[model samples]
Target: MMNKHTQVIRIIMIATLQLFALRNTFSQATAQRPNIIYMMSDDHAYQAISAYGYGLNQTPNIDKLAEQGVLFKRAYVTNSICGPSRAVMLTGKFSHVNGFTDNHSTFDGNQQTVAKLLHNSGYTTAVIGKWHLVSDPQGFDYWNVHPGQGDYYNPDFIENGIRKRVEGYSTNLVTDFAIKWLDQRDKSKPFFLIYQQKAPHRNWMPEPKYYHLFDSVQFPVPANFFDDYSTRTSAAREQEMEIARHMTDTYDLKLAFDLPKESQRGLNSLWTSIYNRLTPEEKQKWEEAYKPSNDAFYKAHLSGKELAIWKYQRYMKDYMRCVQSVDDNVGRLMDYLKANGLDKNTIIIYTSDQGFFLGEHGWFDKRWMYEESFRTPLIVKWPGVTNKKVVTESMVQNVDFAETILEMAGLPIPTDMQGKSFVPLLKGKQKGNVHDALYYHFYENQEHKVAKHIGIRTDRYKLICFYEKNEWELYDLQKDKSEMHNVYNDPAYGKVQAEMKQKLLELKKQYKDPVPEIIP
Candidate 1:
């Protein structure tokens, strides 16, 4: 009914209004930095998350985040150990550059951290839950942390340098305290929160509420659960972690015998207190859940491959149960954000310090350059940007986490930081050269008897040097995805090996790692 000029004018007006609305949204977002909730779970393997399609277990709550935003397909960590990985995430640098090579070393708190940068930029910072770097957290206005690895039940927490005992499950307590801080934070300014989870770390501790989760469930054992370590170096053979051999009944399985510390296993007071602090009803429930299985196992005297399968079943169920709590607690946090109207103004990231072995290659712990241990799971929900689910094949390391958070806040990354921010990749900008390969280093000598190694993973090739034993391993990920066959000596791919070795040296040099260790 309108004239041609009038119709053109109407079209321009509609387009102009839409553009204005978009600019207004962008302006409001610019005025306030996004609140960051970085949730790093301990030893949460990608193979277990349903989003990854491994289907080891169902993680509905965690899958929600992946469905809502970007789920990284090839995320990894600079170091596979806990403390060093956390340290690297904090500093935006590799283990060698940050000086936290392994769990044994101390994290210098005075050094610059992402928390410090955020704090300086008018963002309130808080780090709750597991902070295993052995340094009292600096730069955080409020930090409530677990001492060492922390206890699963009735755990003691060090809050702002004051130790306090909270009577509840560790995962729930962490959420409770984090919410308390959130309620107390300055609403006028944005915030950054590190909600780290200590769940499913070691001893496979699960909350009493989830004690019987997988009681009747039967899990299939890994194809290589009975790996003979054949054709591999002593590092693979001598490793001290295995579901069949290393998992202890006294320390790891909660069979109380009051054995000596070393003879019992690793860390008892926490695992022991879990049972000691259980209510009568809770204790009865736990006994009811585990008694039949424990008694049957002790009487069976499981050995050989039969014993291995039994151990695998027990380990898988307990580990999965612990994982369920993490998913639930993560849901709790996400619910809090949504209920508080913070979801749209926040950036939520779910990942782990490093990946754990869920019975892959007959291994239990992370530290090797194997895919299971080397790759970490990362799902990020950045509201107003990656609002829909998207998956990226680009390689991202935990070290980049700090710089990414910094970049999201429109801040410059410190020159000392070795990692480049992948915010461009997250926003689908189709810009920036992120990474073609990732470098990894492990330097622990005896905790798990894993070889100290340095490695690099390219798009389809992986080269690792177990310099401690002068052992080299190469895997063609496209051809042998399982990494079961080492092809370093294959004449057919001699050039590929040489190219990977060159890249490894270049990365080590660029990252300032010890290059001398790479030589055969």
Candidate 2:
């Protein structure tokens, strides 16, 4: 009935309308996907954060996140060490399953990770800062990571597989690179960015502006600062992490004049290596800040318990100063997000690899399953999803990180992943804890002399097995908050011990850990 030209024109008009509809659908879907920013700091203790209420130091920026989102009170790690905990976070599995059980093992990046899954699902992925798994990052569109436990001043970063030294403090440099990546990324695609920091770790070194930040204020020591390890197993007494005997003057206290002839743990030489990396101008500023304190120490000639207290003061000040810098940089990143109007569509997660000891039980490092070392700080801010200023004691661990992120991105979780997603809990559709019991194991025992141990933590009880030593320790957390008293042999707790032991075995089976059988 119609001419050939008219028929062709009608066909072309219909085709154009269909193509425009398809593009509109794609735009809506992309807008629904939230951009993710995962920020982590090394060895940041929960007690040091003002939001946690210990009041050791003020972290106003980190606390602002808590006030706006959810603050998790009982968040913990799969392992208390650095590399293994990170591996768990990436794969949603324990260290043994991830094949990265210790710091010495290289991560098998070929395996499935959350980053890989997201990248495959059309999201751009990038990781910047400390990647200590001893292997090149995989599943990332861009990566610029630290070589090892990165230096505080003038650090080196391996950018896109080429190593180069960047001038400036490590914390500031990491944040700068993150902002740069966000600015230049593809606007059509949603992104996932890992912004990690190397501050507030061991051998704490603050920036020039923070060197004299806490000079006048004296921090209060923990109630059990002088623990004798009286009732616990031989494992506690044998560890080499005691602050009094193990902490050195030059390396830890930053005293340049009084160098011991024999350095404890060979740390003085390591300190000298780090200090020598500073420029002449930096060195002058450092000396100017520390000289007055060094002179007072020399004049006092203190020793014994008095000297130990002085070391504690010095350690806390330097550690708190480093923490302050991390808080400042967090504020910087937040401002960037707000300025660009990304705050309305971005989800922010702030946490640490593991907790550190600040004179708790006279210890300085993390390894033991004590509360200070085991519990990590977790804060999540989701603009439209989470209830404002929510605080929950729902137990969650590092292993759940991968699965949770995948669910947030509306991607299907891999069947082999072991972690349970906490999206329902976040949405208020689920109540109570996400996990009934959590399992933990530490494989590296050579460094801090903490015996290789496996443990299980429930809501009310904890049971530990020092398998190599054939020892067991149990603690009723409700009664003994400090874990100072071990009740393994107490007759009153006979039923509790038996129940906890059975639960531990069940957890080991559920997680597929091939631990040796314990002789009861």
Candidate 3:
């Protein structure tokens, strides 16, 4: 009955109305969803956080999350290494399932990841800072990642597949990019940001301003700083991560002023390369900070225990200084959130890829089944959800991160994702530990000579299997929290050992991990 012109106009009007209605519906849904800011630091140990009561250093900004929301006591990693832990976090699966079992492996981008899941669900997702996965990040709408284990000074980052070297300290630059992304992100949809930091990792380097921040403070050495691996497995003794023996003067302690010429062969070249990356101004600051210490080390002929203590002090100070910068940047990010009024509706989760050894068991690196390396720091600040400061002893792992984020955003967790959502725990609907027993497997055998191992940790007991060596170790955590003794052969723990072994087998099956052949 209508003319051609009138029919065309009517069709266009209906289409426009439908589009508007759909957009309005999406906007209302997005408003109800809490925005997620997942902040992770590399090799950040639980012992380093003041909120954990270790008192090694003060992280006031990180502690604020603990004061306002929830602090997880037993937050562990599926694997206690950088790349694999991150892969587990993204996929909510074990290392075997994710296909990134170690640092050397490239992350399979085609697989389902939290970023992809969130992006597909209409949430604007971005990942900034250290993406050590060895491949271009996929599923993220925006990605600015470190090329590899990014340098601490004047690092190169790959932004949306475009590589460019940025002139600034790595931690600060990472934060800057994150803030910039937030400012320009789509405001109509809920955002999920993976804001990460590369501070406090290996070869610790702080911002110039914080280079000597911990100079005056003499940190207390761990009680077992002079650990003799008499009772432990052969793997413990074979480890090349000992602070006294393995830590290099040139590379680790930054003591290059007076060293034997022959001592400059191995790691010195690498150290020299890193030192060369610094700008003139940065080099000046570094030289000024370490000159006095280097001079004193050369003057005082410290050897044996005294030399180890000196190395310990230098390592601790440098590491803590880097941690201080990370904390400062966290405060910066928090301030930005509050200023933009994003604090009220956003959920901030601060954690680490995995924990590190802070002179624990006389070691300086991670990848052990030991508590220091296995346990990471997790602090969640969920506005409108968490009303008061709650310290939970509930055992959660990095593998659970993806599911938790998805559930918090009111999205259905994919069936393929292996982690259980802790939304019930967060909402106070459930109590105690979410996991009955936590499984861990470390596949990397090249670095620091930490033997490839599989392990299980229950509430009060831990069982480790160095399957390659046909060796088993058990720790009664309630009795020996430091894990100074192995009770696997103790007659009194026979029943406990049997139970743990059975449980371990069950867990291996449950996680779909293949049992390594023990050459018994």
Q: What's the TM-score of every candidate structure? A: 0.91, 0.96, 0.96
Candidate 3 ranges beyond 4 A from true positions: 1-19, 257-265, 518-520
lDDT of 1 by residue, 60-138 (tens): 9999999888999888998898999999999998887788999989999898999999998878899999999998999
Candidate 1 residue pairs in backbone clash:
none
lDDT of each: 0.86, 0.90, 0.90
Clashes in model 3: which pairs?
none
Kindly report which residue stretches of model 2 are placed more than 4 angstroms away from their true locations once superposed: 1-20, 257-265
User: Which ranking of candidates, highest lDDT first?
Assistant: 3, 2, 1
What does the lDDT come to for candidate 1? Answer: 0.86
TM-score attained by model 3? 0.96
Better of 1 and 3 by lDDT: 3
Model 3 Cα lDDT, one tens digit per residue, 383-435: 98887899999999889999999999888888888888998998889999989
- Residue-pair clashes per candidate: 0, 0, 0
Q: Write the per-residue lDDT of candidate 2 for residues 379-492, one digit (tens) a residue.
A: 999889874888889999999999999999999988889989888888878889999888988888888899999999999999999999988899999999999999997999
lDDT of 3: 0.90
